[model samples]
Target: MSGLRLEPVTFAQACAFVDEQHRHHRAPRGHKFSIGAAQGERLVGVAIVGRPVARHYDTGRALEVTRVATDGTRNACSTLLSAAWRAGRALGYERMITYTRSDEDGASLRAAGWEPVAVRPPRRGWSCPSRPRAGGEVEQVGRTLWQAPGSAQAPS
Candidate 1:
């Protein structure tokens, strides 16, 4: 981990790497930016930031961490989370948020200075005929939303 670096990456590259290494093996759509963590020349992890998928959070100043994928590299997740926040701030976003399934630990997010803000209730699958979605393993699970530290105030 000595030569680890965080750098901007294209959505295609991030999606490819995430599909290979992420547990769910699913790539998110509509990311605004993707950042990668590299160990020397090899990519170890990625974080995808984008507009919030939830309609309630679609404000112009709020962004979301859509995905974080890693190849089991220590500290990669936390590093990518931190870098995502820095990138968002640089781009003038007021708040950054993300969600983790209830059963999943939030150590990486906490290490990146994010705080658990709320626990969202489980939802039924979103597979209506008009808006069919590929069923996901965590689709119906409860999730805990986390926000970057100091973003408690409403986004401007």
Candidate 2:
């Protein structure tokens, strides 16, 4: 096992890391909590967890990992994800979820024991006729939704 360790991370710090390192998505606007993975004094990765993005799942009992960024450190992503779930569970959360682009392999999520439960199709963008908002630089790609501790609420 790696000497990767988990520590509390401020939302700002976590967001900064994600902004600098994430392949596509920008940092999230807000988060409920954040965790960092470190090998000694250096931060190797970060995870930001917040209320579920999907209205249907935003029941105050579920949390979503909005961002995760790693400096290519081994096991850093896996460690941070595991800690994120543990922290959520400790806070009495009933479910934890996160989404990965369709192109991602999700090896770290799988290593952290999260299972893919759904595949969400891509939309044109966040902006539509109802609300006129700026389109993001990142393309709207299909995403895989993953949940921790398996398929308790998963559909057949």
Candidate 3:
């Protein structure tokens, strides 16, 4: 193995990463994963996963992915997705899922094992968590969006 490592992000780190994403002009609604790809002291990529409601489809849990970026030269999609997968699994989720616009190119997700179950635009009027980040600057993610892994579906 070429020495690849993944780490779980703390709430503080998650807030910082989400702030960075917001600075970069991306939506920071769902960002629970917050993984970093580093070789020693250098960070090569970032991947974040969050649990949201599966309202888009009639079934399955919504595991949203955000800020999946790599150093162009290195293929980081697999590493990132794998980290998110492990996190989701650790959280007790049985299956993983994501969403993308109908016209958007989701090659990275496809390459990383995220299958597109729907092509519809995300629903309007998302609700955020009642409690915000401790700091007035950072906002906490929505609570209603996510469900415990085993709780979403009963054994079939």
Off by over 4 Å in 1: 127-138, 152-156
Cα error, residue 70 of model 1, in Å, equals 0.4
By TM-score, the better pick of 1 and 2 is: 2
Name the better of 1 and 3 by TM-score. Answer: 1
What is the C-alpha lDDT profile of model 3 across 119-143, one tens digit per residue? 4434333444753344334232222
True lDDT of residue 69, candidate 1: 97
User: Each model's C-alpha lDDT?
Assistant: 0.87, 0.87, 0.52
Higher-lDDT candidate among 2 and 3? 2
Candidate 3 wrongly placed segments (more than 4 Å): 1-3, 14-32, 53-62, 71-73, 122-156
**Alpha-carbon deviation at 44 in model 1, angstroms:** 0.3
Query: Count of backbone clashes for each model?
Result: 0, 0, 2
Top candidate (TM-score)? 2
Residues forming the 10-long window of minimal summed lDDT in candidate 2: 147-156
